[model samples]
Target chain A: MFSKESLDNLILSKRTVLCVGLDTDPAKIPAHITGTTKQKVMEFNTSIIKATHKYCVAYKINVAFYEALGMEGWQILFHTAEYIKSHYPQHFLIADAKRGDIGNTAERYAKAFYDEMPFDAITLSPYMGIDTVAPFIRRGKFAIVLALTSNTGASDFQLQPMDDGKPLYQKVIEKFSEKFGRDEIMFVTGATHSPMLKSVRSLVPDYYLLIPGVGAQGADYLTTLSNALNASGAGVLINSSREILYASSNDDFEEAAAAAASKYEF
Target chain B: MFSKESLDNLILSKRTVLCVGLDTDPAKIPAHITGTTKQKVMEFNTSIIKATHKYCVAYKINVAFYEALGMEGWQILFHTAEYIKSHYPQHFLIADAKRGDIGNTAERYAKAFYDEMPFDAITLSPYMGIDTVAPFIRRGKFAIVLALTSNTGASDFQLQPMDDGKPLYQKVIEKFSEKFGRDEIMFVTGATHSPMLKSVRSLVPDYYLLIPGVGAQGADYLTTLSNALNASGAGVLINSSREILYASSNDDFEEAAAAAASKYEF
Candidate 1:
């Protein structure tokens, strides 16, 4: 599990806050990797992880992609998490499973991600409020709450004004920031919403922000870096999923992925 | 897959709206059921479902408890879903996995729950707006959105006043109800907040509401039933997990669960 200091040190040492997202879709795997769907996916994940580990300081594994593969998917998910944790201990690992529930259930989810699988951080939905987040706020573990997303649907509720005259996302960031420190909490402020990232940084100046939507979602990387970085020049984990994972749809996938990851150097 | 018409029919035929929640904890299993934790959990789930199926019109499987068990836990979950679905085809099955993510990721989750597992509905956290839910609103399937939860932290955000003077939950219900019909969507209005049930009923008179916090959470059953039911005399699936599940941590646990489930007749 990576703490704030450890994460900052890693970021400074690596000279990049690039968090390679393993949102691996089996259908997108190159035809060259022949086996059952599960085997293909496992091969793709390990290959991608091996190829891109040095270019980035973290790996964000989206649970949905593996889960979609059914029982075999869970097997792949478990193996993938272990592969990353044991093989690359220095890299921060995130379970991009945006799960939110009541307290008791939340504890189980926290256990599933942090204990069952070795994820340093797990993304959470704060709509059910702070108790849903409390179970995951352990030492050296982070509960990355969704503040403002990159999706267009973010405007539907996240941008809606509350009684305090600020948008709901601001209130979420404000409230959660009060409960947990920079070590135990981070906010998912999307790269597409770079201008708003300044406001997010203002609220929690030192806390890391996991920024998605850099490549496929069309957010300018330099703009995101300029607006989101903290005084230490290390506060954002810019994730590129499909852009790097499926950088090439052919036999040269490993090389293509490596090249693509290196191209996003901070 | 159970729809509004089928759910209503089942409720009328069974003369109850009870949804027995399988929030199974391995440690809580009876010592008499001797095996590995996975086998114990599987036996417990099968026995419970068999005993309570006659009394309840639906079953709500909380994903957290199973996910907590790690790899073998998923096997238990897969088997449990298959057991109830194959044996009790008439009952509405729900994955109480308050999952919320962006569009593409949401599609994969929808596939995981609805396609991979034979669930008729899934509970969703609506904070990310409609896109997180759009994937699950298919024909004969329902998307149960979180309107107001039973947790103490609901006051932190769900009950807060938005710019329109209505609380965020009301706005969520209003907006979602307009987009999806009664057959396609249901709201999770907690039983602990029964007084607000009238407001929810007023907004979507025909849509079903999955009410938690009934037994162990200490909400009066009669009050919840009277306030939440529609003109058709059916609309709520009142869920009771702990009280019914751990009715007796002994040899007679099966009969105890049946008796406990029958006591909560709508």
Candidate 2:
């Protein structure tokens, strides 16, 4: 099993906590990596990894991207995960797949992502309750639960109060921490909701928070980073996808990606 | 587009609605079919397909099954979905993969399962509300919403009463049917709660309910079928996975599967 110290060591040595979201949408990827065909998804991803390898501490490949392409897409996803693990062992890899269900189902999921795939972490939605989130934590892999999101649809159910009077997101943080222990878990809070980050850190001060919404969704990095740091001075893993990948469509893709990401730090 | 008539005609012609779940465990499969270690999974799945192709109208392969194998498993999944569509076009295919989220995300998911993978139906959880499920209910494709699941854990949130006093599952059914126009969607209600089927049918008389908790789960078909039929007299697609798949692992595995499933008519 991977220890907390082990994961922390990787994060520290990696220097930047910036997670390059390898959300390589075929339609959006630069024309050069994939000149003119339905193929080259994996090649595009390979180039993205080769380019951004040094700039980021972790790589978060949203499963939906490859999954949308069917077999070839899955091939790209698998190869990408493997390539990341073998070449850059220090880089923390995450399957940005927000999966959640029950114990038996969750166990299968844990096997698929943790035991099977080479991802260091995975994103989870805790709407199904504790059983849904608990199995992943036990495997010693990071289970990033949705704390708050930047989407307009976030108001649908996430922020709504439960019978206990506390908002659902608050209850999730409390319950998940109590059951799973906070270290093996991380919460995904939107970079846009920087104001709430201070209160989130105050609630549980040591755990890492995966903050999305810093790039295309428009969350300010400076405000989110400052507000989300816990008392122990740890929180807010800023994930930037489109901004980093699409930083430049030219031949200097890798350098452009590194330059774009170098502008930010933990 | 998959029309209602086409679905009906196909089901009738096939004369079997047994949705064999290929929740294929790499450990449980025969030693040889999984291939010389690496492609063992693909081998196992191919063997199962060849063995159990008849006596079933649909095959629901849980994404978790292949996903647990990492990229290789995903590769196997891609080939498997492709194989089923090409070889057994008559049989309705299901990616027992439960997917539902926001507009753009759901659109990608729709493309993943419906367009790319091309599963006739894909299961989804309605936790995020109707907007989350709509992107999946395209013209001919079927979106199976989780109405009442077999797991005891489903009782935690799904069957729990809302502040409005009605069970959340009921509201989900009413809302989903109203939005998706009833014809394009199917609800997952287990045979375990055979008693509840009557009430569910009263609410959704014309729609189909994909029942999963039969056989080992102790859902008796005789008891459930009587209670499940609606005004038009047909409802409930009873699925018995372990009962059908692992029935006599010694020899004649496919024959055994066919024998067990022969009782059910579409």
Candidate 3:
């Protein structure tokens, strides 16, 4: 369980706000690490965490990658979360599972991540309404809701103007921010939309923004960091998955991951 | 692989469009069915499916409940999905996991549900834009997108009027419907918002509307069915989870579930 103050202290002590995304794909892991897909994924994840934990303050496990691996995917997911919780107890662990549902279902998801797993925060979609987000708003746990995303399809609805002439994403931030304090809630403002992040920062000045799309998605690192930073100089957790995880497709993949992660260190 | 034609054909043959939702919670299952939580969950799910298969044309497995149970939850989820796929191949299986992410992550979720599991359809949130949904729009599998949900929070964003004067959900349906054919897409129109189902039907007349909120959420089953039906007198799969699953907490739970399901059989 992490409060906003603890997150800030972690960032301040680490001097880097980089959150290495463990979007680990079995096929993409180094071929030299020999075993079944599940074994390889487990080894790859543990090794990556061991190598990169020092360079960053947070580790985001993209649940979809493990989920794609079948039943053992859940096993790997559990083991990875456990490994991070036990080994790197100081680091913030995030489940990059963009989950959302109505109240009861949302409660179930909260139980899945918060009680069953060792995640400090879980990403969620606020599309269903506030009830979908209500269950995740706890004292120490953070509910990182999706705001201006990075994909081209964001133009479809998120960036569209609402009846009030503001984009729908702004309304999402305003509505959620009003309901919950900055400590319990954070917003995912994509790095690809860095320029617009200034507007997001203005809406939720004290809230941390989980920014993805830096490396593989081609967003400028400094520009995103600059635009997304709050007055405290620590309100963003910029993530890089493919760029850092697949830095090298060889036995030295972990070493490469560390080096890639090191570059983002403040 | 279910197409629109095949789905309609199943509805015609089955006589009822009831989608029995397996939102199985460990704490909620019958105490008489003894075992570990996982074993009990599996048994309860299998029995529920066996008892109610005749009354419903589809089964929606809410992923959150299984996820709440930890690692074995995935095992039960897989076994339950396998049980339905092997026994009732005619039934449309929906993994009610409202997932959304960027394109690459979305691709991973597609593999997790479509390739790794036996789900015919997966529910998704459209807040991130169409890119999050693009990967799920494929050949036989349906991408059931959220539109006009039945929760009180629906008033927050989905029901908020867009600059175009139409609610945001209308734009979600209009945009997605234009990109993907009704054969590959379905909309989750909440039964609680039954009156608005008429407007949704007008938007995508031929697409299947997966309606929840009927039983436990207090929406009238008959009224939802009437409003959501299209020109084919089909296009809706009304789902009832708690009302059917926990109809009797005693040993006769399965029997009670069957009786409850039979009531909805047209």
* Leading candidate by lDDT: 1
Measured by DockQ, the strongest candidate is: 3
Q: Which tens-of-lDDT digit does each residue in A121-210 have in candidate 2? A: 888876556667777876557888877776665654455555655555676688777766555888887767777778788887777888
Task: Give the number of colliding residue pairs in candidate 3.
Answer: 0
Clash counts per candidate, in order, are 0, 6, 0
State the lDDT of candidate 1 residue by residue for B172-266, as single tens digits: 99889988899899999999997898889988899999999998999999999999988889988999999999999999999999999999775
The list of candidate 1 runs beyond 4 A from truth reads none
TM-score of each: 0.99, 0.87, 0.98
Q: How well does model 3 score by local distance difference test?
A: 0.90
Write the residue-wise lDDT of candidate 2 on B1-266 in tens digits: 55555655556666655677777766665543535443766665666677667766678887876777766776677788888888888677888877765566778778888877768888887655667777887776789988887767566555655556666567678877877765689999877777788889888887888888878788877778777755544545677777776665654666766677776664
DockQ of each: 0.86, 0.40, 0.91
Residue B111 lDDT (model 3): 90
- Per-candidate chain B TM: 0.98, 0.91, 0.98
Going through the candidates in order, the fraction of native interface contacts each one reproduces equals 0.80, 0.39, 0.96
Q: Where is the poorest 10-residue window by lDDT in model 3 chain A? A: A1-10
